[model samples]
Structure formats: structure tokens, C-alpha cells
Target: MFPKIHALCAAAACAVAASPAALAQQTLPAITITADPRADRGALTVPDTEQAIADIERIPGGVEVVPDTQFKNTPAQTVKDILERVPGVFAQPRYGDDARVSIRGSGLSRNYGNRGINMSMDGIPINTSDGLVDLFEIDPTAYRYVEVYKGANALRYGANSLGGAINFVTPTGRDAAPFEGRLDIGSFGYRKAQASTGAAGGPWDYFLTASAQSVDGYRDHSDGKEQRASGNLGYRFSADAETRFYLNLNRIRQRLPGEVTKDAALNTPQAADAEFERLDQQRNIDSLRLANKTMLRFGPATLEFGLFGVHRHVMHPIYQWLDYRVQDYGGFVRATDRRMIGGFHNEFAAGVKVHNGAIDTDQYINLTGGHKGNLAASMYDTSKNLSAYFENSFFIRPDLALVAGGQFQHAVREREDRYLSDGDQSGRRRYDNFSPKIGVLWDLDPDWQAYANISRSAEAPTFDANTFATPTSSDIEAQTATTYEVGTRGRRPGFTWDVSLYHARIENELQCLTTAPWSPCTIVNAGRTVHQGIELGAEFAVLESALATGDRVWFNANYAYNDFRFDGDPVYGDNRLPGVPVHILRAEVLYKLPGGFYAGPNVEWMPKSYYVDNANTETVDPYALLNFRVGLAPAKQGWTGYIEGRNLTDRRYIANAAAAGVATPASALFNPGSGRSIYAGARYTW
Candidate 1:
């Protein structure tokens, strides 16, 4: 957390006047977290929009910073709740808060456990070294802001995955309210309660948040519960140096409703597979993470370094009683210099990151009543990655800058089979790649900017992607892509817009093929594929003077046009990729008042039917959903309340589908969407 400018200056003065020993021994006074009273007024919470967006725009590609105000007052339980309006981000809720989250179709083929997209909490990596992220481990209420770096824009963080990175930043003592509490109750036996607090004293600051939630899902055998907590402690050793430690824990238990046929999904939306109920199929996880970060400032440069460790245990029963324990640790260091070079402005940055992890896995046959039958097999899997990167921005003109950078990565994947019955199916592989990026940014004016960039990215196979019947590790190749993008973002008066066009040529694409729902999806390689999309977002005030002062109507909308297809494949030549829709659009008409009353009607429409297999024989129907929300948030000293209704038309739709290798209806690939439901919540702050 950063204090007000005055308080920071005062602390800096004291530090400069005192000797090192004296400063270390001094007892400082308590400091309240608040914005600088002397600064110009702006939107509440988070950094000022212009400055923050400027920081994001420096990446020269698709990037955004979504503030908490966008979805905080609603049922902020799922990533889809907030990400639905972000262009290029395709996230749909699965049974619970678990989502099929993908970026530009990066992980479209994955149905369970996340991949392609790197995830972080407050600048600390949350994804395992093997490129797997679990959405259930994240507590929606734990974050105050979310920073999205799409595609190669994430090179600064050593993220080479196709989807780039998502950083959920926590509130610090200087930014959070002293204490806050919230409770939410909704349809289908949903309930949630969360509490958070923050405090700062002398050189010490601390912030903590805890939440518990449960839901009897719309479909039978889909109930789930989760508990999560996160906190951070910080110390400012001097005006130019500071360090922070972060801790996070999660315990999650979720049931699997199992997929059904399209007819059964629409006719009996609440039905669950009988076998799933009999077997009591479920996925449960317990994970803990600890991390530390330190920042030190020199004359014209700053240095940041950090270390992190994680311990995770998973007890799940899907095709089999899967038990896995993961231990991962990593560290990173980064240096940044923002200074003038030979009469021109220059921003230079460089970093090195190392991450390694090992997994101890065991499987057993599922008997019944939460019991494991015979031992199936056992294996030990490990992964390690080391990367170095550098980037620099050179001002060619007062309003233009040229950026060039690249990263070199060395990684290894190994598996040791311990079960003799498995015939010693063990292997090891090494992957190395050098990705490069170059871009240019021109400040069209103070209110807008135009940018363009080209970059290369690479991703290695994960343990989950190695679910071959033979368990051979070297069978799959790393996925690679080369992308070219151009974009423009601008703000004028009461209107703002962000638009970009991008195309990527991918090789050795990791494609998933499944024959039956009873089995895990199989990973295979597709020859060459092309992914191109139009990502657009715009919002503007529609009415102001017609209503009361400071009261207005706004129109917000986001549209994504996906054109992903196979490039001259031998079998599925020129066929569109299965899974994601061809086009997705979301729009909202919102009315707001100065006293904090707001109401909006929103719609989500999938205009193009998408295929369910490479053969393109079967396809999911196109559908649209109508939703509405109303809320009241007076101020920090009062109660805030909201009412949200989703799928108000009670549309019988299939929200997502799992693709199969062989085209057939009996694949049990369709997951039904929830019917009409209403949710209400309230919160208090002091």
C-alpha cells in the first residue's frame, strides 16, 4: 500500500535526517490510509484512471486494468462475473465458480484445470510451474483490482503462455477500509460471508481477508463449499526500501454433476448423471502459498526481487480416485530504470525468473461411499524453468516510442514411474526457446494512443496434458505461436474505447480429443492453426442533462469476433476450431444517480453456432441471455445492497461443451446452463 504523498514525503524527510541505526530504532506514529486531499478528484478506489491506463498502455499490446468497482457490489463470486465484459477473454461458469476460462482460445480444449494463462495474486505467481491454474483456489472477494496482460504483452513478467497473465492485486493497508463485512444469499441455496481489515502503524502495515461460501448448485449432485483466506504484512525499512510477505490458503470441495446429452440438458436441466451420483464424484483441494517481495530504489533505478513456495493436495474422483500432492518453489529479480538518455526519454527493464515443482501422484479405483478400492498406479513428475528477459523503450519523438525485447527460456520435464505393473513408463524431455518482441507506440494526443506489436510465445505440455494410456512423456511437442497485433485506445469526455485486431499462427497446437465423458480428455497435436480475432470495448454516457446532475445513463458493450481454424490439416482441413463460439457480444444499458443508485439491463449473445468435434458433424445452438441488476451504494459509512437476476427469460441453453475426437451425440459433452435465478447481497464498511 502506498500512503498519501504528504505522509510519504514526511516519512522520507525523517529517514533522510536520521542515521541508519537511529532510523531503524525509531518508533513511528500511526498512519491512516487515505487519498491525498489536495489531489484532483477522480473515480473512487484504485489509481487514477488516466495514469493507470497509461501504465498499461506502455506494454504496446492488449492490456487492461479492471477496478473492483466494476463488480464488487454484485455477487462477486466467479471470475466470469467480472470478466464477461472484457474482450478476448472467454470465461464461462462451469458447475460453480469454477470456470472454463480462456484467452483468445488459448485453453479452449481444456475442460478441467486451467492452462495457457498464467495467474498471479498481488504480483505473486499462483499457477504451478507446469502451467496449471485452478480457479477454485481463488477467492473473488480477496482482490481489489485485476490487471490483464493479453498475449505477449506479459513478457515483462516472464509469462510466455499463449494467454499471457492475469494479476489479481490485493488491497493494502493504505488502500483498504479499516474493516468491512459482507453477506450474500441467492437462489439454489447459495450463501457467502466475507470479512476484511487493514491497519498501518509506524513502518508496519498489514491486511487480511477471509471468506466462506457454499452453494447447492442448480443441478443435482453439484453442491460445493469453499473456504479461503489471504493476508500480507509489510515493512518500510527506509524511504527508498520496503519489503512485504504474503500468505494465502484455500480448502475447496466440489461435486461433479457430469455432462448430459443436448436433449436431456434442455429438457431436464436439473438432472445429474445417475452414475455420477452413485459414485459421488468430486474434486477437493487444499493448498497453501507463502511469498515475499522487496523493493529498493537507487538514484534513477529500482530493483524488485521475490521468492515463493507452495504446497497443494488434491483428492478427486473422476475416472478414478486421483490423489496428488504438489510442492513448488520459485524466485525472481527485476530491475527498472526510467530516465533520460541522450536528451530522449527511455524506460529499460530486465529480469530473471526461476520456478520448479514436483508432483507425487497416486490413483485408485473408486468403490463407493467415499472409499478407494485397489491401487491403480503411482508416479513422480517434476518440472523446472529458467528464463531471462530484457525490454527497453526509446523515444523517437516527443510523442512516440520504439520498444524491443525478447526472452530466453530453458525448461525440463521428467516423470519417474514407481509402479512395476505400469512397465516402467518413464521419460524425460528438455525444451528451449527464444521469443522476441518489437513494437511502437504513438501518442495521438493526451486523450488517445495508437500501438502495434509482433511477438512470439511458447508453452510446454503439462502433467494433465500427458494423460496418455501409455504415459509416455516425450510424445507431445511444445506449442508455439507468432502473433501480430495493432490497436488503439482513447478517452474523450464521457466516452472511452479500446479496440484491437490480432492474428496468430500456431504450431503443434495441443488439441484435446475425448471418446466418452467417463474418461479424461486425451491430448493430441494439430498440425498448423490460425487464430485471429477482433476485440472491442466501448462505453459512453447516453444521458446526463435529461436526468439530475451527476445522474446519467450509460451504454457499455464488448464484442469479440473469433476466427480460429485449422490451417491445411490433413483431416480437418480449414475447419473451424471446436469449443468457442465464433462471435460473442455483451451489452448493458445502465442508469446511475449521484446518491449511489444504479440499475442496468445486460445481454449476452452467442451469434454463431460452434462445432463440437473436428469432423464438424454436430454443433451447439446459438443462444442469448437476458439479465438485470439493481444496486444501492450510498457511501463508505453506510450499507450497500444489490439484486441481480440472470437468465431472466429462463432460456434452455447449453453453456459449454466438451469436444470429442469422434463425432457423436453420445459423447455426453453438453453442460446445461442454469435457468432463471436471482441473487441479493449486502455489505457494510467503517
Candidate 2:
């Protein structure tokens, strides 16, 4: 089915390459138009956080811009901390920096690494060409802000996945402190430190930062350490042209505690799977990336282009000792035009991305203490993908707009099995799709808006999902869905709110269901499924001038309701999906006094239990966690301190679980949550 479609796409590409219309469009002049006049248009090549937020709010769907200031006063250790207030995003830590992050129930099948979502740093792809993400390599302290585009609204980034896209924007010399240092210490032998410096002079500007952390995790056999460094250099040729070069490096080592039974998870929360300790399971990675971005402003449009390359090496030891070396490279070009068309306000954005990568894998029998005994298998895998996307907004009325967009993507997956002992498992697959979107936006007032959109999304299976017993799982196919969404967001004098409701009808949904304990899961295609949910985010000023002249009481909360289940399937009819909880709520209240001081209490509650298998026989329990924190806001040139306590009640509960086809009580599928702990930190800038 995909090969035929891909052939048509190839023909279309060739025809467009030789068309006169394409040539005429390329000759048009470039113009610079911005929604915010305060945006820096001269020296900086990228918009600042404030300008970015202002621009993102114009989207006709779910989108968020999270600034680093929201988490700088607390323990900014993981994605969970940085995205805590963002609705529809579920990020939970398993141990150390390793986490299970999903959006709108996307990637709920795979238990390791990240899938179903596109991750980027500084507008460059961070995931491999095969769509696998190494979460441990992401350093939370290195970013100035993050942008999240939910579902098909991420067409601007050429992402056509169910979960959409996340971009981490780094700080520039102009916005960064000249010199800064920070230190953090916490329970369970956790410690971290960071240092940074930035400077701009004449036409040259630079920013550099490095961080290191170590943790003896809450569970046994879950100790880990990591170090990272990132920097960028920018050069300005004129007021309308600029170029920047970036470098990033990471070294990580983590111990795998493995999953435990439901009984052990709730009773002996600190216990590690016995097999994991005996085999000394662990994962270590070394990676480096180099990238370059340039911006050119012509007469009426803005053109941006960039290229990047990454090298990653992994050493993983579990039931089998796996060694992998990967190389990936990509390039992208984007254009934006904001001008009057037919005397109506119009905006158009278009982009194309090309990514290719290869991986060399070797597997061996695991010996005690993470040593290799005998060679088990060897294989080589390669992937290539191309994506082109465009979006246009045309004002039909003074306060109303119609938005349209689509993405065309093509991909090729191939594998070569060097070890013939594994039945010569070699194959190739081709996949392609054209996803379309249409939406409407109405500006209710100067500070409020309402939006509705109907869109389609598609995702091809990654190599990890395809390779268990063969080079490619013939039964595993691409997942596709059509979604309908409606939402409203606004900000009043003392209140802010963002709410969205969505429903998706999916076909051939990919799922990973293991059959045995501690066995690798095999990816399969589910016949049909339905995913529907609601996302809510709100903040209120409970009281102003409660204690002092410039003090206030603030209440902030976010909620997500997931209703995912099979739809008239031949087997497991109408059974709910097993990975995510039915309902999740997070809320906090803080009191601010004089002198940049604030204190807050927060709660994370999951009131309903969920199943862990397609049969819906085994279930996880529900629980709530209480936490508190007090801190002094960071000053430009002085020291600030903060202290936080989490899980004050020490509730024992399951944090994460892997799915299974049919589960028994003895099935080892649960990961325990952390116990009570306290953390403290200090920072200084000069």
C-alpha cells in the first residue's frame, strides 16, 4: 500500500522541480514581518522568549511556550520539572534522568527510550533518523525556553506524528548572564553543578555552558552519572543577514533497575529486579553534535536554513549485551511571508527537511558483571526520510481567520543481517503519507480567542519497534489517525486559562505487548482504536496585597482526562488501553511576600487505577503525592537559595508500567515511585 503511494510522491517531486511556477515563486522578494514590534530584528537571529510566546499564542490549536523562569527557582532536573504546568504532556521519571514521556497517549506502547514524538534543540532535530530519542542526553539547565505544538499543529516543524513536536530554545549572549554558577544537593546522594559564560562584542557573540550530575537513585541498583556541554557562536554580516554555529556533547552512564512485580512495587518499593543485579544491567552513551544556521532577509520574505550532524555510541547490557554506533545527518530550509494579499491579511509558512542515518549493532550473551560471553547477532540498519510542509492563514473578516496546512513525508527503512545464524532476517520497507489540516480562529477580544481544527496524522514504525525476531516486523505497519479539536484560551487581569477537547479515530495503531516476564516486547499493529481526552490549564490570583504592598496569593492547576480504548476489535473488544491513567491532576498554591520571597504547596493526584494488559486483568493502584517548596527569586547580581520537599507523605505507588498481552499477578511490569526526599540549591550570577 505504501510503495504505490511513495512512487506517486516521487513523480510529483520531479514534476515540481521542473515547473515554471516553482521558478517564479523562488524569484519573489523576501520581506521581514513580525507580530511584535519589541522583537529583536537587528542583531539576534532568533526571537527571544517573550516574542516567541506572543507569536505562539496566535496558533489556532494547542500550543505552549514555557520559559526557564518557571522552574529556575526549584529543582530543574528533568523534563517533568520544566513541563509540570503544561497540560496534555505526561512526563514521569523512572530513575535518575531516565523518564517515560508521552503526549496525547502517543508512544504509550514502548517502555524504553522515546517515540511517537519529535524532539529538537535550537530548531535542530535531536531524535535519530529512525525516530528514537535518548532522554538522558537532554540537559534541562541548558535551555532558555521550550515550545510545544500539540498534534498536527506542529506542521511548521515538518512533524506528522500523533504527539507533535517540542523545541528547546537555547539562550544567546545578549540574554545570558556574563558569568553564572549553581549547585544543588538532594536526598539519596544526589548532587549537581553548572557553570556558564556569555559575551557579545562587535559582530561576534558567543555563549558556553557545562553541567554535571550524579545520583544514587531511590531504588536499588539505580545509580547514574552524566556530563554535558553546549555552546554557540554567531556572526552578523548586516542588519538583515546572520549565521550561527552550535556544538553539543554528552556523556552518560546509567544503571537499569528493571521492572518489578505489583506486589514488590507497592510493598518493597526500593527492591530491584534480582536478575538485573546479577547481570549488572546498565546503559552508557557518548555523543556529539555540530550544526550551523543562517538567516537571510530578502525584499518581502525571510529565509532560514540549517544543517546538522550527530555521532552517538551506545553500550547497553541487559538480558543481552548490545553495542550500537550511530551516525545521523540532516538539513532544513524554511520560508515565511506575512503580507497583504487581495487586500486581506495573509501569512504563509513553508519548510522542507531531509534526514538520513545508519546504525551498526552487535549483540552478545551477557555474563556476570556486564561482560560479554558469546556473540549472539550482528546487523546493520539504515533509514532515510524527507518531509515538506506548509501552512497559510487568510483573514476572512476583521477578527476571524481561516487556516490551512499539510505535510508530505516519504521514508525508507532497510536492514542487513550479517549473522546468518538468525535466519538471514533482512528486509526493506517504504512508507509515505500526505496529512492535511484545516482550522478556524476567532478573536473574541483583545485578550481572548477561540479555535477549532480538524487534521490527519501518520507515523512510521522505528527500527526498535520493527526488530525483535526479524529485521522488520511484517505485521507492524504505519499508524494513522484523524483528529478533531476545539479550544479556547484567554488572559484577564487576575485570571488565565487554556482548555482543549479532542477526539481521534486511529487505524492500525502500533502496540508493543510482551508475552513473558523480562522479555523484549514485539511490536504489532492493532486493528482499530479510539483516543479522546480533555486538557485544562488555569491560573488565578487568589488574593492581592494579602501580606504586603507587592504581594499576592496565586493558584495554578492543570488536568488531563484520557479515554483510550479499542474499537470493535476481533480480540480484546472495547478494552481500555493500558499505559496511561484515566485522570491526572496537578495543582499548587503559592504566597508571595516582600523581597522576592515565595513559598508553595503542590499535589499530584491520580484518582483512578488503570490496567497493564490488553486483557485488563491486572491493575495498578491510585495515589496522591504532596510536596512543598520555598525560594528566593534570582537577582541579576546576587545569590539566591531554594529548598524543596517531595512526597511528604511517602506514599508507595507505581510510577510507570509496561504493557502486556495477557498478564498474571506475578508479571513484572511496574516501576515504583520515589520515596520522601528533600532538595536544596543555590545560584549566583556576576
Pairs that collide in candidate 1 are none
**Candidate 1 — worst ten consecutive residues by lDDT sum?**
5-14
| Candidate 1 segments exceeding 4 Å error | 1-52, 467-473
Q: Rate the local accuracy (lDDT) of all candidates.
A: 0.79, 0.82
What does the lDDT read for residue 552 in candidate 1?
64
Across residues 634-670, which tens digit of lDDT does each residue of candidate 1 receive?
6656688899999999999999888776567666788
Q: Find the 10 residues in a row with the least total lDDT in model 2.
A: 1-10
Candidate that would win on TM-score: 2
Residues 1-686 of candidate 2: C-alpha lDDT, one tens digit per residue: 00111111111011111122222232111112333232254334677765666567667888888776666666677888877678898888988898888889888867678888899998899999988887898888788778888899888889999999999988877678898889999998889999999888878888999999999999999999999999999898866788999999999999999989999999999989999999899989999999999887764578899999999999999889999999999999999877777877788899999989999999999998889989999999999999999999888775788999999999888888899875887778889999999999887866567899999999988886666354346547889999999998865555567899999999988887777765677788887999999999876667777677756676778899999999988889999989888999999887765466778799999999999998899988999999998877634567877899999999999998988888899999899999999999988878
